[model samples]
Target: MTRWTQAAVLARMRQEIEASAPDPGDRLPTERALAAAIGCSRQTLRAALARLEAEGEIWRRHGQGTFRGRAPLGHPVRETVRLQAATPEQLMQARLLIEPAIAAEAARRASRSDAQYLLRLVEDGRVATSRGGAEEADARFHRGVAEVAANPILIGLLDHLADARRRAAWQREWDRTYRRIGVGEFVGLHSDQHQSVVTGIAEGNADVAEQAMRAHLLTIATAMRRGSDPADPGL
Candidate 1:
C-alpha cells in the first residue's frame, strides 16, 4: 500500500475523476467514501476537494454533494489558477506585496480624473447597503488604483488576484468574519479603510498611499485570521 500525502492524494483523486470522465453534472462519492478510498483522513480529503473547486475542476452545493465542473478553459492562462491555490493568509500576503506598490505608483502617476473616480468609489462603498455592494465597491477601488499605475503587467496581476477573491473559500471567510463582527461594524471598518487609501492617493503622496494600503490590508487580514480556527490548515 502506498502512503498518501496531501498533494499525492489530490493528484490521484484528480486522475481518478478524469479517467472516469463523468458527465458535467455527475456527482462524486460522498466525502467519507472518497476519503476512505483515497487513503486519507476526511480533513485531508476536504482540503484537496477545496483546491479542486478553487481550480474550477468541481463545484459543491451546500446541501447537494460535489459535481463535475465545466470543461477547463483552453486559454494559456489556466496556469494562473494552478499557481493560486492559496489560503486566505496567502492571498492576503500576495495583496500586501502587490497593492502597496500599485498604490505608490498611482500616487505618482494618477490624473485628477483618477483621483475623483477613486473618491467616488470610496463614497459608494461607504454608503453601500449590503455586504455584496460594499465588496464590489472595494474591489473597484483597488483595481482602479492599479489602473492608475498605467502598467499593464501590474494591472493584469492585480486582476488575477481580484479573481481569486471570488472563490467560495474566500466568501466563507468573509461570512465567518461578518458573523464574528456585526455586519454594520464590518462595513463601517472597511469604508474607513477605503477612505484613507483614497485620501493618500488624492494627496499624491506615494509613501502615505503605500502605507495606507498596507495598513488597510493588514487590518482585514488580521481580522480574518483571528476569526479562523488556528488548527485549520485550510486557513
Candidate 2:
C-alpha cells in the first residue's frame, strides 16, 4: 500500500478504536484479522497499530496483545445551567463579560499565525455577509476570536457558549423577525466593530482590544433587545 493509504488505514483503525471504547484490557483483534478487515497487509496494519500505541490511544502488554486505552479527560463545565440556557439578552451579557478578557489575552499572547488566521476569518465573514450568509460568517468570526485567545480552557468555555447560542430556537426567530424588518446597517456596524477589535490586536493594544470587544458585544445585545434587524439600515 502507498504511504497515504497506510495513513488512511491507521486513521480508520483509530476511529474504530475510539468508537468502541472501554476495551478493558482485552486483546484487540489479531493483526491478521485487522488486515483482512481493512484490506491491508499485516505489515501495514502493524505500522498503524504501532503509531496508535505511541499515541497512547492503545497499549500492548507483554505477550498479551494490544488493547484500547482511556481517552483524555476534558475540562470541567464552567457556566451554570441557567447560563447555558441563556436568552439573547443573557448571551449578550455573557459575551460582554467573557469576550473582553479574551481579546485582552489575544493582544498579550497572539502569535503572528494566530493574527493572520483571525484576519482570514474576518475576510471570510465579510464575504459571507456580502453573499447573504450571515450565520456562517458570524460563527466564523466568533470562533476566530476564541482561537486568537489561545487558551484551551477559554476556547472550551466559548465553544460551550457557541453551542448554546446555536441551539437557541428564539435566536433564529429573532433573526427572522429582524430580517423581515429590513435592518442592514447593523451588519455594517458589526463588521466595523470586528475590524476595530482586529486593529487593536494587531497594534498590541490590550486595553483597546478589550474595550472594543466589549463594545461590539454590547452593541449586539442592544440591537437584539430593540428588535433591530442587524442588516437593516433604517433601524
Candidate 3:
C-alpha cells in the first residue's frame, strides 16, 4: 500500500478535480471515497481538503459534500448542453422569463450583508474604466443578485444563462448592439437600472425588484432589436 503524504494527497485531489469535475462548481467525490482512491489516511485527505477550501479552490456546505470552485457562488453547475447552443434570441427570452423572478427572490432573501455586496457590484459597474470592464461588472452584478437569493438551483440557472451570454453568436449580437449604444449607455442607463434593482432589494421590496429587473432586461431587448429594421438600421 502506498503511503501518501498530505502534499501528495492535495496534489491528487487537484488532479481529481481537474480530471473528473472540470467545470467550476462541480461536486467532488466523498471524502471517504477520495481517501481510498488516493491511498491516503482520512486524516491526510481531510487536511488536503482544508487547504483547498482555505485557498478557495473548493467549497463545502453542511449536508452538501465538497465542491470545486471558490468562496462565493458555490452552487453546482446544471446540465445546460442544449441551452448552450440556443440562439441569442432564445437566450434573451429565457432571461426575460426567469431573471425577474430571481431578482424578486433576492429581495425577499437578502440580508444586510447581501445587499451591501450587491451595492459593491453595482458600484463596480458604474466606475468601470473600459467597455470590457463594465461588461464584466454587469455580469457580476447579475450573478450577485442570484447569489443573494440564497437558492442553489436559481444560482445554477443564472450561471448557465451567464455562460450562454458568452457564446460567439451572443457576442456578435451584443457587440453590434453595444456599438450603437456605446459605453455611455453602460455608465448612464444600465447603471441607473442596476442601482434601482439594488435599492429595491435593499429595501426588501420584492415587487419593485421584480419590475426593475424586467425593465432592465427589456431595455437590453430593445437595444438588440434596434437594428433589425433594415430600413432604419437604427445604428
Candidate 4:
C-alpha cells in the first residue's frame, strides 16, 4: 500500500480504538486481526503500528502485544462550571475566575523579576494591539500570568484552558465581537489591572492584592455579560 493509504488506515484504526475504549490500560486488537479487518497487508499494518507506538498512543510488549497508552494529563474540573466547552462566553468566564486570582497570588508571591515580566507582558500587549497582533499578545499575557503564579498546578490548568480557548470557533467569535463592538479598549484595562495587582503584591499588601484581583475579575465578568446582551439596559 501507498504511504498515504497506510497513514489513513492507521488513523482510522486509532480512532476506532479511541471510540471503543478511551481509557488507558485497554488492550488493543491483535496486529493480524487489525490487518485483516482493515483489508491491509501485514507490512502496512506493521508500519502503522510503529507510527502509533512512536506517537506514544500505544505500546507493544515483546511477549504480549500492544496496549493502549495513558492519556496526557488534562485540566481537572471537580464540577460543571461555566465555559468548560470553550465557547466565547465560557472562555471569558474562565478568565474572570482564574486570571485575577493568579494576579493576586503573583502580587503576594512574585519576585522583582516576576513583576518585571508582567510589565513586559503589558508592554507587549500595547505594541501588539497597535500592530494588529492581538492574538499573540493575548497568549503572552496569559502565559505571563501563569509564570508569575509560580504554581505548577495553576500553570497547567491555565495552559489547558488557554489551549481550549484558542480553538477556531472561539477565536472567530471573539474576533467578531471585538471588531463589531469596539471592545479593544479592554486590552489597556487588562494591562492596568495586571499592574495594579503586581503593585499590591510588590508592596506586600495582601488585602489590596486580593481585593484588586476580585474586583478586576468581577469587572471582566460584568463587561462580558453586558457585551453579550447590550439590550439588557440594566448594564
Candidate number achieving the greatest lDDT relative to the actual structure: 3
Badly placed stretches (over 4 Å) of model 2 are: 1-84, 129-132, 180-187, 228-234
Error of 1 at 117 (Å): 1.1
Q: lDDT tens digits, residues 29-52, model 2?
A: 667677776777888888888888
lDDT of 1 by residue, 3-29 (tens): 678789888788766654344434577
Cα lDDT computed for each candidate against the true fold: 0.75, 0.67, 0.82, 0.64
Per-candidate TM equals: 0.68, 0.57, 0.65, 0.54
Clashes of 2: 8
Cα RMSD for candidates in order: 9.3, 15.0, 12.2, 10.2
- Report the number of the highest-TM-score candidate: 1
Clashes of 3: 0
Off by over 4 Å in 1: 1-71, 74-78, 230-235
Using lDDT as the yardstick, the better of models 2 and 3 is 3
Q: Which clashing pairs does model 1 show? A: none
**How many clashes in each structure?**
0, 8, 0, 2
lDDT of 2 at 120: 77
> Worst 10-residue stretch by lDDT in candidate 1?
75-84
Alpha-carbon lDDT of model 4 = 0.64
> Which 10 consecutive positions of candidate 3 have the poorest summed lDDT?
72-81
| Models ranked on TM-score | 1, 3, 2, 4
Q: Estimate the lDDT of model 1.
A: 0.75
The model with the greater TM-score, 1 or 3, is 1
